[model samples]
Target: MWRAGLPGGLRAVFEGSPLSSGGSPRLLEGKVALVTAGTDGIGLGVAEALGVAGAQVFLSSRRAHNVQRAVETLRGRGLQVSGVTCHVGRAEDREKMVQAALDTFGAIDILVSNAAVNPHFGPILEADESTWDKVFRVNVTAAAMLVRLVVPHMEKRGGGAIVLMSSIAGYQPMRGLGPYGVSKAALLGLVGALSPELRRSRVRVNGVAPGLVRSRFSAALWEDEAVREQALKELGADRLGAPAEVAQAVLFLVSPLASFVAGQTLVVAGGAWSRL
Candidate 1:
């Protein structure tokens, strides 16, 4: 028997009781995420974060061994994960990567274009043609092409998130970085140009610019004591950044929590440059 009023004339209606215990909705449950060059470093970090958040993450790198190793490592952690060998600079490899994700996860809800190359470390003017081409091709062009391929699938799902990995060097070129910095600068522009068009299709495009992240890729910069000290002085952070920190920012950008965020580059450089 239920009463129509409670206590002193206040109406009380009890049609059905609410459930006392229910699982909180994960931000990315059942979602599919694809991350390029994800076998190690920041790419792998992003992949792990997405997988932990309940997304089936697909990762890839140039070497088959690395792909297998990463897949096994993530699987051992009980994350829904898979991988394949892919060189982002090659068209066939890129196609194969996309197909692999489709085959395993059905659809891609998040894309992290994190593959980049910095073959040369010298003045921009002295950079060889081959070095410039390689840097631009992998760092800038491949990212744009991957976005082109993934956007169609994202549209099919109504909307999705895309994160382009840039660098603090994009805003303030680091000494001796030359063409690599230029390529990163182009990524910032790429996000700006594509964000509006991507938004029309309900797909959000954003960028993450990290500064002096400690990884095998940037070992030359941070591993040297003198160089590390100078960088630290400029950055004002006593510690260099870890890949996980960058990965967290990428997770936020692609999550429902950042639904209103789009067409912007979030700098995860630990206060290296004010503009970045």
Candidate 2:
């Protein structure tokens, strides 16, 4: 049920799009994808990757402007995409996001819960109860609730793919990112628990644990020259990861390429020491 091409006035975007550049591959053509926090950084990268693969992407962010920009960028690439301003922590917003996908794409086949927060940067002990609450509410709770909203849509379609945004911090506790890391660890657990049940729905649940990537979200970890150097040596990586790298990992899981792969978290970190 995919639209074949762009409408009038927008044909040039697709004509000049990377899809025509031969750099784009169409592994997910006709699939419908919903990516939360799909405005920038890893989220935007993922949106483009999925769209380039042939999925009609529905992306969202807290800000209207960001959503608009992302939608325009994707369309300019000749990808069929739309956007909604959403606060993933809100129930109303979650409902709207799901409904928008169904309304626009006709069905939902993929979900990437990539929205996350790191409100606290200090030691876990000094972190207030409110900080913990907010972290779990957005990073963990909202993700789970959003899944609940989409599972039925996926079920109706006979099956679907879901990717949660976990992190390398989940496997090894990083000093300043304790609570955030803990929440990501919870996601790893969520993938395991949800997968077994989602199998009946024919839906597959997976996650990606990325290392320190070059994004505004992780600027604190890498922006400083001295700190970046120390962190790189500690992580045993030569350079930082790019959002495109992470997006490709996501693309594989959601695509038919990763069929039979479920409940497993792909570690996208570059030698960041993540086992067990």
| Best-performing candidate as measured by TM-score | 2
**Per-residue lDDT for 1-276 in model 2, tens only?**
011222434345544555433555688887999999998889988898898888999999999999998898779878899989899988998999889888988998999999999999978999999999999999999999988999988888889999999998899888788899999999999999999999988899999999888888899989999888887777767777878778878989999889999999999888889875
User: RMSD of model 2, in Å?
Assistant: 6.3
Question: Model 1 residue 209 lDDT?
Answer: 93
Deviation from native of the Cα of residue 154 in model 2, angstroms: 0.9
Q: lDDT (CA) for every model shown?
A: 0.84, 0.87
Candidate 2: residue 130 Cα off by (Å): 0.4
- Candidate 2 — what's its lDDT? 0.87
lDDT of 1 by residue, 114-143 (tens): 999998877778889999989998999999
Candidate 1 segments whose C-alpha is farther than 4 A from its true place? 1-25, 274-276
Clashing pairs in 1: none
